[model samples]
Target chain A: MAEETKGFSKEEEEWIKAQRAREAERQKRLSRRGGDDKNAVNINSLMDIMVIMLVFLLKSYGDDPLKVVDEDLKVPRSTAQLEPVDATVVTVTRRAILVDDDEAVPIREGRVDPSQKGSGGQSSMRIIPLLDRLNDAVEQRRAEAQLLGEDFTPEATIIADQMTPHRLVLEVLYTATEAQLNQFRFAIIRSTTESVGGIAEATPEI
Target chain B: MARRSREEIGQPDDPDLAPFMNLVIILIPMLLLSVVFLEVAVINVTMPLGGSTTKDTDEPPDERLDLSIALAPNGFYITAAGYQRPPIEGCPTQGPTICLEDDSVDVAERFEEARRLLAAGQDADGESVMEEGLQAYNFRELYNMLSGFKEDFPDESTVRLAADPDIPFALTVRVMDVSRYRLTESSYDTNEAFWSAEFATETAEDGEEQFANLFGDPAFAVVQ
Candidate 1:
């Protein structure tokens, strides 16, 4: 009977010892790798990439336009930073030059100065007709400002077609400046979702 | 230590980056798609009137060159505030944009040359065949003439550009370009550049690379 009791104790101890060994192996692994799971993958690289890209996009924001582009006018695209503001607007297209919707001058080599009498004398820098019109606009603006008790600033914006000759465009600018409308802004067409070169990158077909 | 060990023994480790990572992932693509790469620059021009009827008060003390450019049907009539030299004039009635009497340009040839210049890229050689075209105006001559003016007055910063009502707007911008920079033969690559004395001040950081900064300040004025 004593032999039988000793045999049962030995068998039970052997089974308990096997279970303790498995538990100790698991604790050793947990100490080496902490309580974290083995299947976890590191994404430090992806996070770093995301942070860099976010900073780059923040610097590319831009301002909005003062008015919609005229249907007849086609403005040039440039990487200029200044924005257009509310003011008297001039639209110069291939067909005609309009100052604040008033037909200021005809297209082509049409003379702003009607006096074609002088040859070697050299034409005066000022265009009388255009100046008179601009002065009228300036005076009107001054009167309105006086009524509102606001400071009067003579300003006008020119939206010229990119294809128009520099001389014609300059004339409009020169004319405006002569009339005391010196402050100005040139309109440009800038858009997102469109490449500046007007061409999209080709996608590879798999 | 014994209490902490007992508390943390069986807990699974977890990182709380779900909110931050999710935010970054969403923000990056939204901003990238809406990004506008096109730069829009505004050139500020102060036109000095020949005589202001509005106010006749304090005059500017600085004697900066009041050099003015008048765009005529024929060409440019360049003058100054205090008339020191007779106004320089050019541009023939029938020539390239700014015609000199000696210049003989066929409009058709210039058009053909421009077309060929574009197609040369698609050609096998792909070399830029024509470096420059005969502009409607003599921009090369304009550059040379303006360079002479710069040499005469080193301190002058502004030039009053006045154009005719009939002239094209591009000619004004081109004249502005030629006035400010010495265009290289390869400068045809860049169509327009904005520079005033302010350009020199802004770009002075990089001392090695040289840039053309002529009369950087451009004032657009009209003939009174």
Candidate 2:
């Protein structure tokens, strides 16, 4: 064996030294860490909390009685307890009124134009364009319902701004009623502080 | 701060989860108790089929007292829609006194106070000073009168919440609450021990079912 080692090259001798250093380093690390990895943290309990948080967050999401499309419309606060059912949407912002993303009525500075047949300063109550579009949408929905063999109760969710005038709201209602979309849901911010028939100590959340 | 369950403080094989478990145990129940993490509710605001709907009346016109409330720039007006009775004004041009009651509660003053607080910033309960449409109207007096009106016409199912073209939709909704239900005082009625949850789950005549809608909430908004 001594003769074979003498026969070996200088590179082989250096490789053996490096291997010894690596083995020594490994032994040192194992001893320092008490024969286990110290970098790992016990995260099983944290995972439980994460799961719980996910479930809670999921439950709170998308449960609104009505889904609001326009982010501009700040719904009025209410203590109404009825949960929202899925339906066609009528979104009335401070500036414009839309039905299923279609601009059914034009509003300038929160008032319908006098030029519009059934909106603005005009007292006709029938938003002609709005009515027409809603009727078409309703008819299309009715057809879909018929195809699916579903009972179609023309359900419509009115998503209006809290600052929207009562006049505009009435106009929307009128237009909706004329279109035969009667089932209504007034979108509102959930007020956990107020209740029906209780002294509404809640300050108005605009 | 956890006591050793397995007597393995420095053991690298096991992860020390006592602290995390402790936090989660407290957090789960707290999230369960909160309303935001649970179900959200909505209100059903429906109108009659035709252009306008008259109240259900079997009595003569004189006996039928239809409650029609109009909110204008000057003040709040309560009138008999069925008949042509002159409106009873609350917060008229002269003062805050409504229906001969010596109410010192100044609607404008209260509104200013509320606005100041809001400008400075406030919590949900702190904003109670400015109820119903965010106008500086006397909600207490309004409540007192409505509650009395409820006594007068216990059978009245609908109330007309009419407003000027300028009145915002939010105020109308708040006014609806004032007309249809009674509000409770805030939990923190004092200097100490503020219980933020003071709202009562409304209970109807059925007792078990909540949402005791005081006015039956058959309200209508007149356009034009």
Candidate 2 scores a C-alpha RMSD against the true structure in Å of 10.5
lDDT of 1: 0.53
lDDT for residue B211 in candidate 1, whole number 0-100 = 53
**Lowest summed lDDT window (length 10), candidate 1 chain A:** A197-206
State which candidate has the highest DockQ. Answer: 2
What does each candidate score in C-alpha RMSD? 13.2, 10.5
Regions of candidate 2 where Cα sits further than 4 Å from its true position: A1-60, A65-71, A101-103, A118-121, A147-150, A192-206, B1-40, B49-51, B55-57, B81-133, B182-211, B221-224
lDDT of 1 by residue, B54-170 (tens): 123365523445676666444456655455344234543343233432345443344344334323433212111111222433444455556666766676767777654434444
| lDDT string, candidate 2, A19-101, tens digits | 56766886787678666455545576768767778576546653533444233555666655567777788888756788887
**What TM-scores does chain A show, candidate by candidate in order?**
0.54, 0.62
lDDT of 2 at B206: 66
Q: Which ten residues in a row have the lowest lDDT in candidate 1 chain B?
A: B124-133
